[model samples]
Target: MTRLFNDPTAFADELIDGFVAAHPGHVRPVRGGVVRATRCTSDTVALVIGGGSGHYPAFGGLVGPGIAHGAAMGNLFASPSTQQIVSVARAASNGGGILLSYGNYAGDVLNFDAAEAQLNAEGIPTRTVRVTDDIASAPASEKHRRRGIAGDLTVFKVAGAAAEAGYVLDEVVRVAELANERTRSFGVAFTGCTLPGASEPLFTVPEGRMALGLGIHGEPGIGETDIPSADGLAQLFVEELLAELPEGVASPKGRRVALVLNGLGSVKYEELYVVYGCIARRLQEAGVTIVEPEVGEFCTSFDMAGVSLTLFWLDTELELFWRAGADTPGFRKGLVSPRPRVSAESGVQKKPSSEAVMVPASEESRAAAPRIVAAVDAIAAVIDAHVEELGRIDAVAGDGDHGIGMQRGATAARAAAHAAVEAGAGAGSVLLRAADAWSDRAGGTSGALWGVMLRALGTRIGDEDAPDAHAIAEGAADALAGIRSYGKAEVGDKTMVDAIVPFVETLVARVIDGEQLGDAWDAAAAAATAAAAATADLLPRVGRARPHAEKSLGTPDAGAHSFGLIATAVAATLTRKDFAR
Candidate 1:
């Protein structure tokens, strides 16, 4: 992996030099790799933010009129030395003392503190504000000691706004402290992030598993678990934050939340927003009103595949500064909020209620209740039986969550079946029931994909006749087509398609070959078994597990494994009578 750099050692310095060259009126580079952005005056208190590099628009790009006065930029993922922080402190501070801010990291505290004392000796009163918003880092006993994740932007913005509004150094630091106190963040990593010029990642996150509570530096999060959808993951993250919310943040007045959807490194803002939509819905359900939301890559790691959500409890005054107009290169003034602008608008605005959307299940779904229930029960049993086997394979190539995912899906499917049966619903209705239940229980693409397949199959079953080669083959074809339509994956993607494609194809071929339904199913099962084996030679073509393509070269996909298990269950449905003389 090539990087955009002249050299790793002087990457920060060279970038700062070029930046000053490009914007001479805006900034000037100093010793120890600090960039003092212009407007260095003796009248106003200065804002100094610093940290390791790679998280751009931070500690550097954020330097401007309403942002930081100057930034003590560090090397890539490396905190600046004490001397560097001290030098930037002096350069940025004119007559007014400085308020220093950085993420919650040991090296940053040490270096910045040393700089603070040094500036104090020079008659420049200095204060340090540490951003510690990651709620996943510690419990209440250690909340003050948790690592800062993405909420640093809110801290920077609040602190900078205070300073720009002519607040004294002490007041500016107070704002920073308040921002940190109000904020909480948590995240899960899909994969570890690799640093610039490094061949390997800073850490390894097992495939198909999300490391909940993962730190910015690729640290272990809550023990690895099955990767859920963007919606489910957001729910988990928000619930964790809600569980750990500090006392004294009430609603409608003193209770306002400032949300920050921060990209850890490589995850895009669009994906982050999909997760944010989940969180927003849940928070509203909980009666926590959003004061303001800043959604974008405010703070980031180095191409780490993860996202962090930060919620800051706000007071009336703090909320004002948060909404205050400011223009930084990356963070600009936000849109006019729907709330009363307090700037004296003419008329009271009417808020529109949402229109309800309704979709009814297909009639086919209403007719196939018994078959759907039986299928779900048998499939659940298969998962229960092969749990250890699936885990063993996953342990070799992933974080070992495949068994958990499958079992969870089966459990959900069974629950949906039971509910449908109790309600006297048909198969199609039961499948529609399974869709939401399965998504709630299972976490990844396969989980939703399979649930959709079941739902679609249920709808088709209304037209399905009693077991016969032609009817069975057609129904099987419908199920497979529905799966393909929902998942949008081609055959040979090394997914469940390995078993699914051949299983359906073989059944169709057998029916055309004049076989009975039982004989066709047998043939289909055998073909699926072959496809599962053939998966050993295929490459991954989709999902989070795709990157590790070559790694599972000789292993059967868990999807294929799950399909084979289902086929076995279907085959077992056939029985032989006690043989007589």
Candidate 2:
């Protein structure tokens, strides 16, 4: 368990600050995360890797000359905000394009994809390669959907080496995709990890038991079993990976494989070495040749008592990149020459924008700003009331951060809305400000979705006029479209879309049928509530919950639950006498 921390919320920031202070030669502080202190060759592709921060050396530690050029580090167990990824990418970009790589988690995918689109829109070429190497997460037929584990290193190394070799963006992406395909990983945990301020572990195993197929985010394993001996565990890992060879590889025998016997936090290096002894023997007996085996913590879950084994089948091309010399804060190989450092004053911080975007509004629209603020406040209060329960529900199948992320987003939105109202902003401007604050503070899939939803609604409810029932219905429809456009989740995917779609459809229908705004909203909120509750019967087809879909069989999605709760809360504000007019 984590024992030292001033505040759990500030832990990630403080950790990054200390890391930069300690490794000034390797990494420098950037607005979103840390970038390589060493200069990169102009016109060489830049590799930017990132994810939630708990995985130590995985992201920030890998930023240097022969690895990632920059890393977009996020809060503990949450994906980096889109802005963070963009900033890091921008700082790392030279004349060449940017290549984004990371584990294939839902939040990471959503945020990274958003940043990729934005970079492209700004005329900076960008590409992404999601590492999917955890064989336990999905079936062979659906290998593309597997979660990345320790195998993230294999992909990142190949991509980074390709970039350092001065390969163009497309070639670098090809090498990354090939590396992802060749890598396979499996893991088991003796115990779950605890967050800094949490009293208990995120999940736990019974004494003398081990959890199989565990995720790095403290998600409970898919199954449990009696603890196995070191040799037994190594055999289990080797057999599982050997069962499914890469498409071109017929067998592990005679293949040169790069192996990583990684300790997941609390597991000691000596323990890994003991396990690797068995692994080495097994591979030699099977006529497999091991090349440059790594035995230590690579990607970790804070203090999880677990280990994972990754096998990267190496071809001639991959072997060259795999053996390439590299230097970084965490991992290093061979000799690396020092490069010039970026000036701290010029490259360290990104100045905040002082320019404000003020949209003109009519007197009637401006008068409705207080109601928008009240609506956001109501959302915050309702989320606060049910936050714990929502987290518990999410913990059943997903990482338990949904409640906290939503709470943070709602609280920030409320503050931003109130501030905008005080500044004589209208309903649209208040909602737009709230959207920005929500996305900036929350920093996850839920945060990005909420940002899109609010911004879409605000665009439809422009500040030039008092929004009527028709405009409100249109705004709801636009919100739905925005969510679908950004998140790509369908109505039956067991996400917030399940509730949002129903709410939007019902609201639009009721308003078209001549119902008042308040009446339509009340009806829509009821529909959302029912839809959220009904998610218990539907299997999750997207997000982090998808891997543990069975575990969530009897529980509603946390995002859906929060959406329903906020819709109901906002209905009250809509029905108020002063706002109803």
Candidate 3:
């Protein structure tokens, strides 16, 4: 959702206009959406950069002191036209020389190369440097086939430094080529990006899986994998990228590397740390000292959910250029980092929800109508306390928003109960309406399953037939059959079935003596506890969660626990008279 611009078609112009507007003293706009630094140094070689839109600062924002002399901006993710690039080349060229530079991709090659040839024809001598750093793109024998990712920033900096140091255009281009030779990148995608005005993803990836080796332009990846933890995913990328590096590849004569922890688009800085932590450890383990690690959104694809790891093998020369002072809107040499004085002992801690399985218990004829309201309130309170925990569990195995789902459901249920109370609705009617509200607000697998059980209870208690013990038993049986049929869940499947089976089995047995509802509820709760405990033995059979399904064996299913608690709380407060409504 990079919507700071007004028009999708006019994105290039709008973006360049904004850049010039923000730094009036630093840059001047050229036609075809290019911007050049206003300051002049005709004696020095000039650096010219160009790229498509959405990769900010690579071309435009980087046009400032110690960076690019000019930038050519293109339509959203579309390569700049030959004319657009040549326009910038003419403006950025100093009297001494001009060096053309850009990331390597098919469209970029066509546009920038055409511009370079056109510039030479016009008698303005120029040299071009192409950046291609993504190692996953091809084997070493075909390294030229790799795509340029975040590594372009480093390549541009080296080229710019050469130009700024009064080197000829040839020398600047030569240094840019050397930087490209040593750089490599790898990336993983948790989600895909949508092009502006397009409804579907630019690339396709199945839900709940990360696409490995994907490029910035929504290109296909080697494959998809499930990542349940940050550490696990980092290992996969680092180990695979380093395995086939050519001898003499990677920092100072291959002794060290600089890292760019780049967020492609929508990934947050908070989540980036999880990946960076693992990457730093792997680099240290491989005996590669990291000179300077930069973490931020330098390269992006219009809110795509991914990140790329780029390594620069530094020599004394390139290391000096890296350490040289430079500032761009996106690329900064040094930003404020708070001192790492650890006063903080930190502990750090997905999905549509599933349904709850509920069974009715037979109760003796008794009077206890006044306490039902208190019981419903208690049930809502229990749901509130576990909302955050439930969401965390779902995120691990599912879409990672179950906490939000549960909170919404609990809030709606409580509101419904209060609304009914204001209108003088009775205890049974309040529970009925509250359950309906929950079903309407919470629309996942969990919602429907729980809804069916609550509806069955309200109907059974509200019926005029005065259901006998056997009638209530039959109702409980119906609820069980519906959940099994609808959710297609099986016992020991790591689903609500774990808690549900025991609760129903116990209630069915207790009905024979026409037990009081409160007493029957207590029995069912005990059974639920035991059943949930038993699940510690089974591995997960579903939910697309990786490796942890084995370790999750000891933890109760969050969905099942929620189901049991709600049912037990309801049954414990109602008597035979309470069922009369």
TM-score of each: 0.56, 0.96, 0.56
Tell me the lDDT of candidate 1.
0.68
For candidate 1, give the lDDT of residue 203.
50
In candidate 1, the residue pairs with backbone N, CA or C atoms under 3 Å apart (3 or more residues apart, or in different chains) clash, namely 228-443, 264-301, 365-428, 365-429, 368-427, 369-427
**Candidate 2 structure lDDT:** 0.89
lDDT: which candidate is best?
Answer: 2
Model 2 segments more than 4 A misplaced: 348-351, 579-581
269-385 per-residue lDDT for model 2 (tens digits): 888899999999998988899999989999999999999999999999999999998999999977777799887666756435563867778898898777778889999999989
Weakest lDDT window of 10 consecutive positions for candidate 1: 339-348
lDDT against the true structure, per candidate, is: 0.68, 0.89, 0.65
| Residue pairs in candidate 2 whose N, alpha carbon or C atoms collide under 3 angstroms | none
Clashes of each: 6, 0, 13
Compared with the true structure, model 1 gives a TM-score of 0.56
Q: Which stretches of candidate 3 lie over 4 Å from their true place?
A: 1-5, 250-254, 334-581
TM-score of 3: 0.56
lDDT of 3 by residue, 1-581 (tens): 44454544445556677776786655666644444444556667778887667777566777755668788766555456565677777766767677878777544665576677888899888788888787766667877766778888889888877776777777777888888887888888877665543444545568788888776655545567885488886787677657755446633233677788889888899888888889888878887788888888887877788988888888888887777766556666743222122121221000113322222222321112125446667667777776656544543333323333444445666777677655555444555666666554443445545555655655555423344445555566667776776556789787777787888877777766577555665787788877766665667664322223553556666677676667766665556654321
**Which order, best to worst by lDDT?**
2, 1, 3
Q: Which candidate has the highest TM-score of all? A: 2
